[model samples]
Target: MNELVLTLGWLGIYAPMALGAASSAIGCAIAGQASIGAMTETEGGYGRFIGVSAFPSTMVIYGIVIMFTLNRDVTPENAGGLFGIGILSGIALMYCGIWQGRACAAAINATKEKPEIFGLSLAPAAIIEGFGVFAFVFALVISAGIS
Candidate 1:
């Protein structure tokens, strides 16, 4: 049981970054595909599509910050905190990444049809990023409370 607890604690320490990177990769890929499609359809303004596709990459950065914030000596006393914080934050970031990708893809598609609304189309992705930021902030605050 002691070994299991310590192993899980170690898992907790790494989970955020691993999960976050995966989320970002998937999100970026999804949006990037839409970006490519958009580029093929439009004659100009390629930069905005690339920019929108990159929005979901922020989740990976947030995950990195959360992982570092949660990095402390994990003993039996702190294992629960590590696990809860690491896992919960990872899940939140992953969801945010996925949804943010979808949102970005939508933005790219819509803006491809109506170039004038490009900035406005990004609102949903920005809002999704806000949720990821909340999770990141919550993890950091809670991790500070742990020993």
Candidate 2:
């Protein structure tokens, strides 16, 4: 139905931001809990723990940007493209955020034991972030051709 299509189009337009926020919230919470635990064990380097916990927040920003980019008149013609790209990219970003959080938590736990490996420990999280970037870029590029 045309109404269903337009409704889905609207859902797609907002899905990225909503999903991304959920992703960031879960990711940040996971890393933040580890950071808190680590902080209690260590005497210093509190800043880095807090910083690492915030890494997952980037997904929400990406989502917001993608939402804006996808914004337009939601008609049956473009609704399917919007839904597919928005939902798929949102899922990718969400996956990245959640996994990145776990990675950051791992890094925090490891670095708490061996402070010298701080930089190296972050590699996994950075790599996860890269995957999110790829999704973001793909959405942007593909959405441009939608209508």
Candidate 3:
């Protein structure tokens, strides 16, 4: 029993951050591809702008994890803490990007046919961004050592 516990503990101590990072990276990549698909399928020529706009947010997320790792005494047992923080931030950025892309697409369509409906079409996107911001705030709080 003691040996099993020890083995489990050791595994726990070294697995969370690594697994979380890989999983989150995969999710972020998928989200990125989805966003690109949205832009390319809609705007046809705004791929560069969409790519550039999304880059900063993604980099910021990666930087947050790197900085946290560099500055903290992270271990597998506490890897959940880091993973939670990263997840929060990544979700926020991804949500915002997806929402904004949708809004932009809607606006483009509206302008081509009914300009006055632009404001209505934008409401959902803006609301989605708010949810992302809320997630970011909560994640920041947790990552800042509130746990």
Off by over 4 Å in 1: none
Local distance difference test scores for all models: 0.90, 0.96, 0.47
TM-score per candidate: 0.98, 0.99, 0.48
**Which tens-of-lDDT digit does each residue in 22-96 have in candidate 2?**
999999999999999999999999999999999999999999999999999998999999999889999999999
Q: By TM-score, how accurate is candidate 2?
A: 0.99
- List RMSD in Å for every model shown: 0.7, 0.5, 6.8
Scored by TM-score, the top model is 2
Better of 1 and 2 by TM-score: 2
lDDT of 1 by residue, 48-132 (tens): 8998899989988988988888788889988888988898899999999998999999999999989999889999999999999
Best by lDDT: 2
Error of 2 at 84 (Å): 0.3
